[model samples]
Target chain A: SQQGEEDPQALSIQEGENATMNCSYKTSINNLQWYRQNSGRGLVHLILIRSNEREKHSGRLRVTLDTSKKSSSLLITASRAADTASYFCATDETYFQGAQKLVFGQGTRLTINP
Target chain B: EAGVTQFPSHSVIEKGQTVTLRCDPISGHDNLYWYRRVMGKEIKFLLHFVKESKQDESGMPNNRFLAERTGGTYSTLKVQPAELEDSGVYFCASSPPGVTDTQYFGPGTRLTVL
Candidate 1:
């Protein structure tokens, strides 16, 4: 079973537009990270926001986490054609052995048009 | 400076056959993980290896699947008598096992069982 679920299974937008994807989790998380997968090959780490933090930013990517609601959102501003890919949100939990384990969401497929 | 590497980008085999996939993690990374995503499903964790020991393998499905890391540098996952349900993309990831570090991923190996 997966802990996180991302909304908007598919999205299409023009270049320079903004794309937003939302993720909701079931349990408490130590940290939530976002990744980008191009053509289902490899995944690239995008950004990670700890539970204590509310928001984080890197380049054109902005992530917001609301522990109260157990949900997070990724906002990509000024999107480009290169940004077209599948976006996934992963949540990390601490096991009894004190190791961090990651659980991923279903992912959102975004298409950027030029 | 190199990313994680995986061999046999894609494979297609008939049911009841065996398949082996290899992953070479980045040097000096102590934490290694294996995950897979079936068609129309989320990525699920298969196991975790810290150094040469198997720290967690709760996600392994059955006895037909086996994973090993000899010297903690590289790992191999072998499936004997593969089934149709085992067709999916297998991903390998590694991290430094510390605070505020990200997990690096490899370009997964896609396996298709006919």
Candidate 2:
């Protein structure tokens, strides 16, 4: 089973507008990370928020995590045409007795209209 | 430094044939991971390798899929007698072991099993 599910599977917005994507996971997670993928390319790490932390920011990207609700949201401000890509939320949970591993969501396809 | 690299970028093979996908993580990265995503499905972890040792392989579907990292640098995933279900983009990620939740990815190898 997939660990995380992202809502609003597709989103379209103006280049300078803000975009928000939500993700809900099933189990308790050690941490959650967001990544961006351009067409036919691999994902690039954006930001990571641990369960002990509530929010994190990196440049134009902001990530919020609510461990109690097993949910997280990623906000990309000042979006650009280069930001048009698939965003994915991946979860790290305990497994193999104690080791932690990451499982990914289906991804949210965001289109920044230029 | 360089990022993760994978080749050949795309491969098409008949069912029952064998295919090998290779990944070279960034220099000095010891942790390597393999993931796959079928059409309309979320990306799933296939395995993880830490410096030539198999750290976790719980996500591998079956014996037909085998992953190996030699000299703790480049990794290879071989699918023997490939099935139609094997068609998808295969992604390879690498992290410098102690970095909390940071994984860099390769461009990915698109495998087409016909």
* Index of the highest-TM-score prediction: 1
Worst 10 residues of 1 chain B by lDDT: B95-104
* Standalone chain B TM-score for every prediction: 0.95, 0.97
Q: Estimate, for each residue in A62-84, the C-alpha lDDT of model 2 and write its tens digit.
A: 99999888899999999999999
Q: What TM-score fits each model? A: 0.96, 0.94
Winner by lDDT:
1
TM-score of model 1 (first chain only): 0.95
Q: Put down candidate 1 lDDT per residue, B1-114, tens digits, no spaces.
A: 998999889999999999999999888888888999999588888888988899889989999999999988899999998999999999999988563137899999999999
Task: Tell me how far candidate 1 lies from the true structure as C-alpha RMSD in angstroms.
Answer: 1.4
**Interface RMS deviation of candidate 2:** 1.9
| Clashes in predicted model 2 | 0
Fnat of candidates, each listed: 0.63, 0.68
